[model samples]
Target: MSFGALSDIRIVDLTQMLAGPYGTMMLADHGAEVIKVESPTGDMTRPNGPWHTDDAQKTHGGYFQSVNRNKKSIVLDLKSTDGRDALLALVRDADAITENFRVGVMEKLGLSYETLRQVNPKLVYGTLRGFGDPRTGHSPYAEWPAFDVVAQAMGGIMGITGPGPEHPTKVGPGIGDIVPGMMLAFGVLAAIHHARRTGTGQFVDVSMLDAVLAVCERAVYQHDITGTVPAPLGNGHPFMCPFGQFPAKDGHVTIAAPHQSFFERLCDLIDVPALKDDKRFASPELRGRNREVLEELLAAATSCFTKAELMQRLGGQIPFGPVMQMDEIAEDPHFAARDMIVPVEQPGSARATRIAGVPVKLSETPGGIHSRGPYLGEHTKEILRRAGFTDSHIDRLQAALPA
Candidate 1:
């Protein structure tokens, strides 16, 4: 039972950077055999820093390591016939293949879905495009280069994500890339389920803009609920009072005491019990209506206490948590208890590094980070060998890569 959910599955990951890699990583974490298909240069983030190594040969940095655990690397010079043949051979037995290129990059490689289906009709082909693939719906900006910022700006998140309209801010995390990656992962799984039953695989796609909009779906309904469009509310919730970030003496804390009981509990904790039954702030609706005044009252009390002091009084009494820095999270017992902060082997670095572990825990058949990601083309020979390539064929493919 411990083999895991997707232990029987395999993926040919022809993707680089965040969006595609993150999707494949999700599958890989589920015990799928994820074969990372890379060009000779390897994934772009492999060399970019927050680095742990000084050696050029083993320069895979935090960005690549974070998303690429539990995967194998096989570099291919797709421009070469030998390399292309090697990839096609691998695809013939793979359950799915994923790529995050522009509209026609797969076609340019002569590895379009039509071509691959001939080799393996049961293959689930997934594409994570900037605007989406032409098969789904071609965009006027189909060929435009895009990144996390572009998706956030155009996908409606930036419009309602800051202290004020004039000072809109990008979210700290790369939700544009990561959210699309998450959607693509689910898309791949759904397509695989269908393909397994019907023996006819289909194309699955998710555009960055589409993913961002889906994640920000609340904004759409907000406009529908009221005639007015949504706007930024600083650290406050649109419809809930005492449900946002508040200043502590040391840092900030987020307290979500929006319910009657929770609100009463929070009011007592903050020494504002008089407001618990006050007519103007009695119910959730009234509190929401007078959110500015309510928040100011809470802020006045919260600002007087340190983060630790607030936690001592409010922890577990209401939906309350202090804004934790990385160091605090690292030292936190809860994360350790849940096995969230995991130790990972860093290849060139002398010591291992701690990384965020898989959060979705299962009672049985749990999957995990099997190993650190491989060095550039580290598994090229091994993967080709598994594909039934002869030693001479493998040698030629290796030689095809530019030195």
Candidate 2:
């Protein structure tokens, strides 16, 4: 029940969808008081699926529930003078503010870093964009729309994600969105710490394209120095042999024998002792040279065992695991024990729902979702009260809601 490290922090979150919201959720999980400011229409993800079948009324789409917990929600149309002014008041005492709007939107709203710093010099301001801000490149479509897929494709992840150029693939999850959010969260915290020390807040920027490139660092380095585009090798490590996915009886198992010794150990386990002595397969470098033949031998050995048997016998012996699906992850005992899957009660819904839990664990002050994601404007009155507005003030603001 106690959020650990960030118990004293307060954040005003004006982000939507994935990146910004996910970042704030990290802070919220760790006990920060995060106030989510939404338009009257609410966060776009609120209606995104995996809704509770038993009860529809309380559904806050699985996406929203997954990323938004342990936070309060307040409805404010930023375009409204009353709403913008109210947010500015909240900013005065807030530790941080996070947004993922396209560049220049905040500035147009008169809430840019320069403006916010004038009000509260120690406020950490975090922002995210599809590409970097205009300073990096002249985006012809600077105001063009974008999402996870666009970032992955444009940022070079898709170029090296599959078997070949003709079959480029995107990762299973919206990693493009999620990774930037994580990086931004860390940046926010870093800025927060520095601001607390020096009484000076700084802007924290995370671009989805930049984040994808960072994730694909190997590809960038190889291309920059070697003048070779890293091709998609499927699940194989480009430089490491015997360190990729192989077919099991029913499914695939990923193996990671990064070093020569581990490759020998893997061969011994699979009863392929001759492979250990083969000159073309002896060292990591040589194995890479004979990758196809080695893979064929491994496939033959691995095909005899079911994934479960292979895991039991070889999981810790070498770095190996079965390619798991969502259902498999839900049923995993280790995941359950680690509290990776948590059941949350959504009021007004017929049945309780389960979702992924907070990843970062703190021993002394563990953090978790305190409540389900808020209904649109669920805390409007409360947030207004805290912002030093009287009931009459809130009523006036309500009357001004955009038509």
Each model's C-alpha lDDT?
A: 0.88, 0.86
Pairs that collide in candidate 1 are none
Tens digits of per-residue lDDT, candidate 1, 151-230, equal 99989898889998787779999998999999999999999999999999989989999999888889999888887888
Candidate 1: Cα lDDT at 318: 94
Off by over 4 Å in 1: 53-58
Candidate 1, RMSD to the unseen true structure: 1.6
Position 353, candidate 1: lDDT: 65
Which parts of model 2 are misplaced by more than 4 Å? 135-141
